[model samples]
Target: MSNSARSLPDVAYVAQPGLSGRLDWVGMDDIQAPVMLVGEDDQPMRFPARVGAFVDLARPDQRGIHMSRLYLHVDQALSTQAVKPALLRTLLDGFLASHRDLSSRALLRIRFDYLVRRRALVSDNAGWKSYPVVLTAKLEGGRFDLELGLEVLYSSTCPASAALARQLIQQRFRADFSTQDLLAREQVAEWLGSEQGICATPHSQRSSAEVKVRLREDVESLPFVDLIDCIESALQTPVQTAVKREDEQAFAGLNGGNLMFCEDAARRMQSALDRDARITDFWLRASHFESLHPHNAVAVASKGVPGGYLGGSTV
Candidate 1:
């Protein structure tokens, strides 16, 4: 075929426009891609990510956007450089520049699982834990915004259940020892160690915290590890990756010391996040997937900044 015969037609531009209204966003979703990330250890790694790239259709007369151009820009930028705020800003700029007069706003969302090696509570063992993470960047009206979303799984012990269980244990001890005026320390210890003496146990269930934070404009790198550390520290009962008997005992002690309701969990997270200077605004939901009940208990909190998150239970 001749070179002229092989040329493709640009239907989006050449075809007669039927749509007359502008759109808030136009482009694609679930574009499968690979992104590079630099971990806290300064090692670069590649992870498979689901990406969404879009640009606003500012012109009402225009038929459509150059979807291929957005795809190409996403592909080139994500595959080459590590995912960072600067890279995201530049990519959004490219999205706008490609459509010059046609678009004035751009957005990109990248979702992936970030794995971190975590050590056991009291053992010399470590294993990898995967945390779900989403990075969203938006450029509108010459303003850039970056939001980071993450989920942390931890253990939540019901404070009410713990109190009731302690009451039951005390009753069992009094009944078992009411016959004797004076008891030896060894005998009492043996009875306490038996399952019959400690007749009841508190209920604990796996809980989840979904947090979204709008990062400060001056922050350079993604603070995934730091955020995770801050949250896990606040909760004090993060699910273990590798456990020995000693580690299990230590975890049990932690759960006993940190009994909380869903509201308590939410407030703990809110307080911890409020201390971080890197985050400008944040919204978080603490959900306790209950063991003693069929329904989950949840609490939501926000930074309470004026014109910030509306205290919704969403990420």
Candidate 2:
């Protein structure tokens, strides 16, 4: 080491007058970093993540924290190892250790696009879909907490619209065949195949479900794919990728069968999440971007656990 570099004075050690106050959180946000994550298939993949690292400034007299130490720890821990509960705990421990008495609570948030290959509804072709995901870890008062968040897109067909469309079709059929009695089977079949037979179609819109779950501390793995599967199973109309004619037809069938309002969608999600034992608490919001109206339809739900998410509408 150069003698000149060692002789440089550090200003953080010299507390200026009127600068002694504690901060709730002190660190950096929107830091670009790479992290290795294990997917549902147990494959390790590297993803670019936007990271936020912070520590509470517990010591009132301290001027500031060692921001570089937090950044370096995050970079070293995430870049080298696959992200999980244990690794996150160690990273938070490092933050508190580096700051010593200056901080107590440490929190880390990583946001990334989790890519998964999805198959068409009834075709051999498949394509990749990117889901926006966030993983958060917090350590405070000798306790560790972890939360996972995800967003899934699907199709939502209004049930009232479907019923109304069916009524319209029935009325059209009555008007077309009112004067004819004992119609030929082939003639009726031809009329049913025509566009005039099924004129009115129900309104369906692309919808999104945003969910956040607090996992039990003993949980070993991140359940990103499991949560996605549960949501898709309940909704049964996830937006498709790499569609063929048959696949599109099948998707249409599924949407037609699984007609739901935003409230029904939210209830389905709530019921599914309630059955998962690993999740201690959860909150979800189902949003339907309405095609008939300019406004969107939305429903929100929560696990309603004591000392947990309080059923807030935001997701």
Which structure among the candidates has the greatest lDDT?
Answer: 1
lDDT of 1 at 31: 94
Model 2 quality (TM-score): 0.95
**Tens digits of lDDT, candidate 1, 14-77:** 6757859889999999999998999877999889999999999988888889999999999999
- Candidate 2 — which residues are off by over 4 angstroms? 1-6, 17-19, 313-315
Clash count, one per candidate = 0, 0
Q: How far out, in Å, is residue 249 in model 1?
A: 0.9
Stretches > 4 Å off in candidate 1: 1-6, 313-315
Per-residue error for 281 in candidate 2, Å, reads 0.2
Model 1 residue 195 lDDT score: 93
Write candidate 2's Cα lDDT for 28-75 as tens digits.
999999989887667799999999999998877777888989999999
Worst 10 residues of 1 by lDDT: 306-315
